[model samples]
Target: MHLVHLTASTLFGGPERQMLGLAEHLPGEYRSSFLTFRENGRCQAFLDEVRQRGFAGEKLRADFPKVRSVLRELTDRLAAMRADVLLTHSYKPNILGRVAARRLGIPVVAVSRGWTWENWKVRQYERLDRLNLRYLDRVVAVSEGQAQKVLAAGVPADRVSVIHNGSRVADFQTPDPGFDTKLHSFFPADTSVSHVVLSAGRLSPEKGFDVLIEAAVHVLRRCPTTGFVHFGEGVERERLEAIIRERGLTGRFVLKGFTTDLDRFLPWSDLVVLPSHTEGLPNVALEASAAGVAVVATAVGGTPEVIADGETGRLVPPGQPEQLADGIAALLADDRTRMAMGRAGRLRMQSRFTFAAQAAAYQKLFASLGSPTVFLQERVTCQQPPSPPSPEDRNAPTRPGRFGSPTSSTT
Candidate 1:
């Protein structure tokens, strides 16, 4: 099978990382490539990562002013590639990719990472995404909650699939000694022993780093030895920095912008916190679970699916600094409870949420649609169809499906 993946933005985040990871792990028999929008430095960096994994990637500069011409150009390119499926990520590509693929009668699978209505512009994009999703063959939601939202947005329930984001356990299972030493260097010379609280992601408004700052004030008043650190870079950095200064938390709460070495930091953390106001299925929490680090994250999106309330981690209501403070403080105050939760979290990750498991699910989805070299499935049946089937589909028994893929029988 041949697959072409579409991404609107080149910024490296959870969604982008997951797409690249899937491309890397997919079955060798199937050919997969990337179609990226935006040809800037960040996009170039993303291409570098893709090449490192030995995947063919192409970037098209998106000029919104010439959108009609751009879509026509992209549609021509998609026809030339002869890919059986076009899997799209993010709002822009999901909207535009579907439009281009539909002209050729090629199947399009739209990935809904989560609709965070952080601003009017984002909301507008999501509205367009919903409109586009209704036209696409399939919608992959990262969380069940996100799947519900897609259904509510007018997409048929039979057309939405919940595929939880997966992470490599080995990536966070071991800590680099050199990187760990560098992490220690960030601490103040006067501090001999301190409880490290870590949070890492894009420093965006929807991430709720501002709320985390407010919670940090309460945490510091109660526990002075706790050091709070966030590793990410975004437009919210300046605003968060100003809030940290205004709250007089320069020493206690630290912002270490965009560190690629999470293995170093996760090992050193006493506890990890995700104060995001919204999420699909956060990769950070999954990584924390893989590292066996106790997590205190807001009860949002598919977090409840990953975290078993009091079992693996504590979940607090979003935007509640007091409650966020309480959850963090509770985890930090007791080492026994915290370590037990960490162990449970690691066990949960091992049993589920691995990269291999996620890849298998996607491969099944692709196979059920038919081989890329053959005619695509024309029907929109939610279950596996009969007759001149794809090799994988003919050999493997059909499992219950949550979504339908675009299928057209070969004569």
Candidate 2:
């Protein structure tokens, strides 16, 4: 089967890693390729990595607002590749890929990660994405929590599937010999930092980095030698920096920007923290578990499904800096308990969040969509059955509470 993944990638982050990992682990019978929208020139990073991994990747010349041009290009590309199924990532791809796949008579599936709702424009795009979900052949939610949101958007239960993100455990097994030297380079030469607490993700509002900076102030009061370092970069960098200055956390709290080698430093940290207000089974939490480091994260989205409170790590309410600080300080204070939790987290990741298991689930999903030859023959022979009418076609109401009430609890 030739699987084509359609995405509008700006950077090579968690979702990009997930795509590469899936392609690497799939059986030889399945050939995976990538198509990305050129976000000016930002899509090059992901496309470069795709080529380095021996996968076919292309950057579309047309972008959003050029809907007709994009559709024409996508139709030609999919027809040329004879793609079996198309898997879309975020809002732009989901909306456009569905229409393009329909033109080619190929099944298109959308991977529904949770919405960030960062700003006015993004929220509007996500609203359109929600409306677009009901027309796709299938919707794959990254977590059970997100699956509820998919159904709430008017997609039938029969068309939804939950597939958790997998951890690349092997990537974290080997220790970098120069890790200590690299760590010391991030801080001043005169400073003596005893422990490090690391966080990584796009530095956006939904990531809650500002909340993390607030929590660091309280944690430093309790464990003065403990320093906080963050990875990844986005629009919130200036705001987070301002918070660090206001809290007098200069040098103590640092934003290290985005790095592709996060795994090299992940296992060296004393603890991993995820302060996101929303997520779709966060890859940072899974990677931390694979690195044998405990996590302190908000109990939002699929995070609780990854971190077992008081066992693997601590779970606190989102946007609560004091509670988040308490969780970090308490863990930092108890070395034995923290180390034990790390070990348990590593075991949990090995058993539940392996790439092998994730690939198996995707394999099942693809098999249900039918074989490549069968779909091609059906299209060529004009024997394809008519698709059932969508909710929009019947003029059915698909308001927020149409299917069921949204759950109040995060877990």
Candidate 3:
């Protein structure tokens, strides 16, 4: 089976990473190609990581001219590839892919990462996503919450399938060898043993990072040894920096910007915090879990899907810095508790959220639509091979999945 995938932005956001994950981890038997919009996508790093795993990749420099141009380019590519299926991420590609597939006689799968942002255009975006989903052979929501949003937008309940985004277990290097240089270098050096807190992702208001900055004041006053660091850059940089300075936290909070090497940083921190007001499934949390780090996150979106609240990590009400601060403090105060939570989180990830499992799920979804090679009931399994080990797997979970792949499948 041949599949062509399309997306508008290539930033390493939730949906973009999932698209990369599917392309990278799909069983070698089925052919897949990924096309990203624009010359340099933030998502390019993810695709590069895919190729590092030994798969051929293609990138397209496409952009929006008008609504019609999207459909035209989509149909053009679909025909050129003679694609049996066109899988699309985000709203623009979803709509274009659905319409183009209909015109080109191919199946379409529309995958929803989550709401782009809560804004005036949300209704318009939601409406278009609904229309696009209606035309899909299948609609996949990255989390159950995402599925609810799909139904709330007027798509039928039966039309949406909730498939949690998968992470490349091999990409995680738990002992983040460059923990100091690549990531933690931005933080104030702790001459004495200190409390360290780190958060990764874009610098947007929706990330609730400003909330983390607000919470930092109390954390700093209470614990002078505490060092706060953030990795990621975006529109809210100046604003977040200003808030940190005004709060008298100029020396305490460090904004490191985006880095390709997060594995190094996750292992160095006392804790990882995700203050996102909204999310589908977060790759950072999974990465942190794989690195044996505890997360203090807002109990929004698919976060609950990965975190077991008090068991694996702590979840607090969104937008509440006090709650976020308290949770972080509680975890940091007890070394045994923090390590236990991190280990539990790691266990959960290795068992259920590996790239191989997620790829297996996607293979099934594509095959179910009769686009990718279909599996008979007698086949009784999937065709994706096991995920290759990343630099970090030296201390990772040992058990591999049992999904059988064709012997001819490439490693």
Candidate 4:
């Protein structure tokens, strides 16, 4: 099958990475292409990677001033590709991609990682996207919490699928000695920093880095030897730096910025923290867990689904610095418990959330829609039903998988 992924992304976040992951790991029977609306900065960077990886892709400069022209061009290009299914990620693509696919009578599968709803503009976009969900042939939510939100928005229960985010387990399982050396170089040779607490993601308000910094202050009072290191860059860098200085946490809390090779660095840390105000099902959490690093994250939006409180890791309430600090400190104080949690987390990741497992689920979704190579044929329109199955094929017992049930929960 020929699948076209449409996205308008300004940054390389979990959703963007997940899209690429799917494209890279999808079965050989399927051919994939990427259509990006924005052609600058991170979007361009994503396109560059897509091209380098030998995927068929196009980057269109879709500016607000030339939206009508861009949309026309997008429709023309999508029609020319003759994709059987068009999968869209992000707000702009979800809204615009669905409209264009409908025009071509092509089926659209929209992905909803999570809605930011951080501000009025984001809320408006999310509201519009929620309304647009009704028109999509299928809507995949990363977490059960997100799936619930989609159902609440009046989408048919049968139309939504919950597929958790996954990561490369072996990458995290294999230790890198060179990265350990680099990690040590970041701290002084004869100074404190016994415990490494990592927080990675874009430095945005929705990520709640400020709340983490506040929680760090409290954590330091109890465990001063601990070092809080954050990865990734964003618009809030200056503000976050100011807070670190003003709070006199410049030494304890370190912002490492964006690192392309997370596998090299993530495993060196003692534990991971995700203080996001909201999330769908963060790939970072899965990466951390796969690395055998215990997580302390907010119990919001599918987090509890991943973290079994006091089992795999701790889950604190959102925006609560006190609870966040306590959760971190408690885990840090008990080495045995922390190590056990990390082991449990790794098992969970390997058993339920590997990249291979995720790819298989998506492949099943594509096959259920139609034949694997339906798009390759000229006469077979995307909307047409496949040829009637043989009696034996119809009687084949259906195996249970991620999409076999209405709601599949790992926890």
Each candidate structure's count of clashing pairs? 5, 0, 5, 1
Residue 284 lDDT (model 1): 88
lDDT of 2 by residue, 70-111 (tens): 999999999999898999999999999988887787888898
lDDT scores in order: 0.77, 0.86, 0.71, 0.79
lDDT tens digits by residue: candidate 3, 1-411: 777777765455555566666766777777877766663465576567557765555555455656577567767877888788778877777876666676655767777777646455755876667655654667777766666666555454444676776655555543645665544456555533277798998776678999999887777666667888888888789988888889988767888877756666677788999999998778788888877889999999878887889878999999999988898878877889999998888878778776676777677666566533331221235223223234353233222111112101111
Error of 4 at 39 (Å): 4.7
TM-score of each: 0.88, 0.91, 0.83, 0.87
**Regions of model 1 farther than 4 Å from truth:** 191-193, 370-411
Deviation of model 2 at 85, angstroms: 0.2
In model 4, the worst 10-residue window by lDDT is 398-407
Q: Which lDDT tens digits does candidate 1 get at residues 1-411?
A: 678998865466677678877877777887888888874546776777777888888887554557897798789878888877999987888888877776666778888878777678888988888766776767887777676667666676556677777766777655766765666567675764378889998877889999999999999878888888888888788999999999988877889988767756787788999998888788888888889899999988777778878988899999999999999988889999999999999888878786676778787666665543333334333223222324453244323233343211100
The deviation in Å at residue 212 for candidate 1 is 1.0
Off by over 4 Å in 4: 188-191, 370-409
Model 1 clash pairs? Answer: 376-408, 377-407, 377-408, 378-407, 378-408
In candidate 2, stretches whose alpha carbon ends up further than 4 angstroms from where it belongs are: 371-411
C-alpha positional error of residue 173 in candidate 1 after TM-score superposition, expressed in Å:
3.3
- Number of the top candidate by lDDT? 2
lDDT per residue for candidate 4 within 1-411, as digits (tens), equals 789999886665667677878877887988999988764555776777788889987887664447687678778888899877999987788888876776666778888888876668878988999878866778888888787777666565556787777766777657888987677567665656888888898887898999999999999999988888888988789999999999988767889988877767888888899999988888888888888889999988888878878888999889999999999999999999999998899888878876666787787677666642443342245445333335564344432233333333456
- The candidates, ranked best first by TM-score, are 2, 1, 4, 3
Instruction: Say which candidate scores most in TM-score.
Output: 2
Which pairs of residues collide in model 3?
10-43, 170-390, 173-392, 176-264, 232-257
